[model samples]
Target: MNYLKKILVYALPYKRYAILNIIFNILYALFGALSFVVLMPMLNILFGENHDVITEKPVLNGLNNIGGYLKDSLTYSIQTFAENDQLKALTFIIILVIVVFLLKNIFNYMALYFGTFLRNGILKDLRDTLYTKTVNLPISFFSEKRKGDIMSRIASDVNEVQNSFLSVLEIIVREPLSVIFSIAIMLTISVKLTLFVFVFIPTAGYIISVIAKRLRQQSADVQKEQGIFLSILEETLNGLKIIKGFNAQSLFNSKFTDSTKRFFNFSNKMMNRQNIATPLSEFLGIVTIAFLLWFGGRMVLIDKSLLASSFIAFMGLAYNILTPIKALSKANNNVKRGNAAAERVLEIIETTNPLEDIPNAISKTNFKTSIDINSISFKYEDDLVLKNFSLKVLKGKSVALVGQSGSGKSTIANLVTRFYDVNDGSITLDGDNIKSLTKHSLRNLMGLVTQDSILFNDSIKNNILLGKENATDKEIIDALKIANAWEFVKDLPREIETNIGDSGNKLSGGQKQRLSIARAVLKNPPIMILDEATSALDTESERLVQEALENMMKNRTSIIIAHRLSTIQNADLIVVMQKGEIAEQGTHAELILKNGVYKKLVDMQSFE
Candidate 1:
């Protein structure tokens, strides 16, 4: 129930539509009950049952008698208006029923019409909030989550929240009001029969509730299975090539089939439970009606105390309440199902972000002096990845890190970029602890070129413009030239405007890597970090990208993480790392002259 209220808070902005829907639902319920009650006077007239028809409206004494007085008053007015002509009275009664039925349907349509805005508005806002939260969450959060699971929350889970919100709202206001209004009319007809009807209600409610007891758990299982299959689909799409190369199609097929099988079983259980509501309510309804017929028959026929016409109208009113009661039963089941979805949706929205910036954090805008890694130690999980690692880079100089895999070369880049916080010690920018700086301000001063050559499926110019949204054509051209990507780019049909296709697959590996460098150059930040920017290329491509890197690094504070020994031979300082600790630190020639770790690495690369 708390989860239900949490989701409802998103309805604040659209409360106007919500209020309007409620008002219309109220009117609809009133007219829906009145639609049947209006025929009572007509039935009385046709049956010649009104023995004392008055010529004027009767006066109401108080609220308690208002229902009885109104019924009597309507009977008198119809009798007077028709001038005691039976045919004329029947004709007028038929017209009144038609008007009442039409108004009931109109209000029903209006309720749904306004409800559309409230339902869909909540949907749009919830999805927007979820997406913004997902994007702003720290990268570490995604390392533990499946991409498809997040997608399911945004797409499927939110949809369920919207549906549940409206279903509960409709049950809370519309259906219950319908039953209440119809029951009011029944009470006016016969306090005896209405009381008998009330006796069965709680019993019916208890039974329906018992049947729906496990619905929430079952619904959650179904929703979770949906997330699992969606994850499988996403993984299959991303690793299709690997699956095909490894001949593991049967493995994925079995996995998908198994997930779907669970989804199938869970769905069957939930739906089979929900399906019991209608018939069960109807059976309960008929049982209550049977009691009414037996009891009321004593008054109408055997005892001759109640009018036959009024008893018939009372029976119709009793049946009217059944529709809403049955509908309420079904809606209750849906809300229980939706409860599971709401819980899943709110779980993500309510999650605590571990990387939130500190209060009064400095928004430093420029790079000055040096970045001092003061004995920083960090870990991704249990074991440490960086152990008391300390290094310094002066402004306008390039320092390259060379190491084998798992040697913490990339961890340095990640820490400096503020992608993860250090578990111990501190990294300070210009002598102020980086934790004091806002992450946005910290990242703004550095441009990163990663090994993957990340590119979007968009125009070359648009992809470069991501570095600086307001950059001009000349600035972009200059950046491209600096990164050595302009020559090949200028030959394309659309040149800078040419679409790169997915991950720039239309271009060669060298071309993609150069575009990544061009994007960084266009940003033109004071610091540049290149993580193996040339390791994945052929010698020709490596030479071209290495030259581009030199141009981009000439006037910036640069930290280069590389595997290819030749790429860092000219770095101002070379730090060779081994197993989370720096094994050597000096210029390339200096390390070689020492005839140690750097010397062996260079020897190995030379042999290869």
Candidate 2:
């Protein structure tokens, strides 16, 4: 019920639809009972009972005996009509039956019509919140989670929540009202029979409850297995090239099949348990009806207290109770299933982000003097990636960081961008700590070009425009020219309008890197961080990309994490790092003369 309440809170925005649905459902329930109530007069007519004419109109009585008065009034009208024209009386009764049925169906349709808005409105809001939370979460949060599991929570689990949880809103209102109204009519028809019905209902409810004991746990297991298989599918797609390269298709296939097999077993158990409620409730309903027939027949035939027409109407009202009783059982099962899905979705939605901006964080818009990385220490999981490391890049002065793999060169760039905060010490820009500034404002002052050029599967123009949201055509062309991308772009089939495939796969390594540089150039930030931007390119391509980097780095306070020594030779200051500590820092000429780690690194690359 707690899970259900949490899920329903999303429906508050669309409460008008829910209220309308409830209103219509109430009307539907009233008409549903009245539909059965009118059947007594028609049955009395067919059986040739009540042959005496009603000379006077029936009187209006108090609310206590309204049911009895209504019955008498209807009988009087039928009898009065029969005296003048028997065909007309029969026709009137048939039309009344049809009108009652018609009104019942109309209210039912209106209830469903309004319910559509509530169901779909909840679905849309839930998905939108899930997607928004997923995007807003820090990058580190994904490191411990499977992409497939997250995808399942957003897609499959949300659908389950809709079907099992949100879908019950209408039934919860309509079905119960139907049962209540039907029971009320049944009580008026015969109190003794209705009392007998009350005895078996609790017994049936208990039996259904016993059958549903393990449904919630089983449903949770099914949802978990779904996430597992989806994870395997996602991983398979992402690493298909590696799998195919190693001829491991059968391995992934077996793993996926195994997961699906578990899913099948769990799903079967849950569905079988869920499927039992309908037949069980229905079977119980029939038993109660059969018992009522025997007992009611005794009263009408022998006892002579209950009328034949009233007994028949009582049977109809009793039957009406069964539909809703069955529906309530089914709804109970659905709620159990939906609870499991709700837990999974809410887990993601309610996660606490450690890297969220502080309440009073300053929003710094521009860069001024140097960026000082103080005695900073950081770790990802157990191992320390950077320890007591520091560097300073003055305004408009390009600084380069050269190091071996895992030596924390890229960690510096990550820290500067605040993608991850340091465990100890602080990084300041123009004397103010970077953590004190809003992440958006901090990142707004800089542009980054990574080792793998990240471009969306979009047109070249759209891809470049991401750097500056409202950049003009001429600005895009100039940025592309500055990055040396315009040469190849202009020669393409549609030039800048050409569609790049997924992750810009249609373009070569050099072309993609140039486009990335063009995007950064378009932004034209006060500072630029180029992390091995040309490492993946070939000789000629590297030269072209290197030229573009030089153009982008010109007069910008640049932090270059370089693999190729030749590229950073003209840097104002070069810092050489070993492990997590800096081993050397000086100009390229000074570093070469020192004959330390810097000189040795240069010598090794030269030999290669």
Candidate 3:
């Protein structure tokens, strides 16, 4: 219930709709109960059990005897009509039943109509917030979490919460009111029979509760299995090439099949348990009804304390209670199932982001003198990736970092960009601590291009426009031409409007890299961080992409993490790293004269 309450808090904005739904449900319940009550006078008319026709109207006295007075008044009205004409009286009673049922259904529809807004509104808000948080969270957050698990929470789990929790608005308000209204009429009809019903209801509820006891745990297992299988599917899609290349498709297939098998088993058990509620509650209701028939029949036939017409109406009221009771039982199961999903979703919405901007963080608008990394140390988990790392990138100068794999060259780029803050010491942009600046404002001053071309499934122009939301087409074309991408882009089917398939797979590797550079060129930031920007390219593609990077880096304070040392020969300063520490620092010509790490790397690559 606490989980359910947390979900319902989203409904606060739509309180007026909720209130309207409640009002309609109340009307629906009132008319639904009255529909059965109207049947008594008709029964008397049919059985010829009515005693006499009365001309005087019955008067209301006090609240306590209002039921008796209303019954007498209805009988008096029916008797008067019958005296005038029997056909007219029978027609009136039949029309009254139709009108009562018609109003009941109308109110029921109204309740459901209003509830639709509340359910869908909450669903939209939940999904939107999840996406907003997912994008705003630091990149490091994804390193420890599965993408598919997060996707499941946003897509599948939120849907489950909607179906199980939000959809219950109708059942919670309408069904219970129906039961209450129905039971109240039954008590008025006969206290003994109503008491008899009370005895069995709690017993039936206890049995149903026991059946649902393991439902929540099983539901959680089902949701967890769903996430696992989805993760497997996501991994399969991402690594299909590797799977085929290694002929390890069978291994991935078996893993996926095994996960689905568990899901199938858990879902079967959970759904079967949920399915039992409707029938079990219905059967129990019938048993109670069968008992009532015997007991109430004796009161009417033998004891003569109950009227035949009133007894039949009481039986109708008793039967009416069964539907809502069954619904209430189903609703209980739904709440249990929904609570499991709600817990999973709330875990994400409630996660405390460590990288969120601090209060009163200053906004940095431009790069000034230099970026200073002073004795910074950092780690991913417990293993230090960068230790006592120190460097300075003076404004408008290009600095290149060259190192072997796992030597913390890329870690420096990550720290300077604030992707992951240093575990020790500080990185200051100009004279101000980078941590003191808001991330949006801090990132606004820099542009990034990674080894993998991270393009979306969008038009080529739209993809580049992401760097500057309001960039003109002419600006886009100029950026593209500068990155050496305009030649290929102009030849595409739609020119700049051509769709780049997922991750720009439609374009060649060199073309993709050029478009990435174009995006950076469009942003035209003062600081450009190119991390292995041409490492994955062949000779010809590398030549093209290298030219693009050079064009983009002109007059920018550039921090380049290069795998091919040849690409950094023209950099103003070259730093060689080994084992998370700087091994050598100088210009390319000076580093070669030092006969140290930089010269060794250049010689090694030249030999390769």
TM-score of every candidate relative to the true structure: 0.96, 0.95, 0.97
For candidate 3, report its TM-score: 0.97
Write the number of the candidate with greater lDDT, choosing between 1 and 2: 1
Best by lDDT: 1
Worst 10 residues of 3 by lDDT: 163-172
In terms of TM-score, which candidate is strongest?
3
Put down candidate 3 lDDT per residue, 494-596, tens digits, no spaces.
9999999988889999999999999999999999999999999999999988998998998899999999987888999999999899999999999999998
> Which ranges of candidate 2 are over 4 A from the true structure?
52-64, 77-84
Q: On a 0 to 1 TM-score scale, where does candidate 2 land against the true structure? A: 0.95
Ranking by TM-score: 3, 1, 2
Clash counts for the predictions, in order: 0, 0, 0
Predicted candidate 2 versus true structure: per-residue lDDT over 270-346, tens digit per residue: 99998888888989989999998999999999998888888999988988988887777788788888888899999
Off by over 4 Å in 1: 62-64
Candidate 1, 136-206: lDDT as tens digits: 78889989887888888889888987888768877989998988998888877778778988898889889
- Candidate with more favorable, higher lDDT: 2 or 3: 2
| lDDT value, residue 255 of candidate 1 | 96
Question: Candidate 3: which stretches are off by over 4 Å?
Answer: 61-63, 79-84
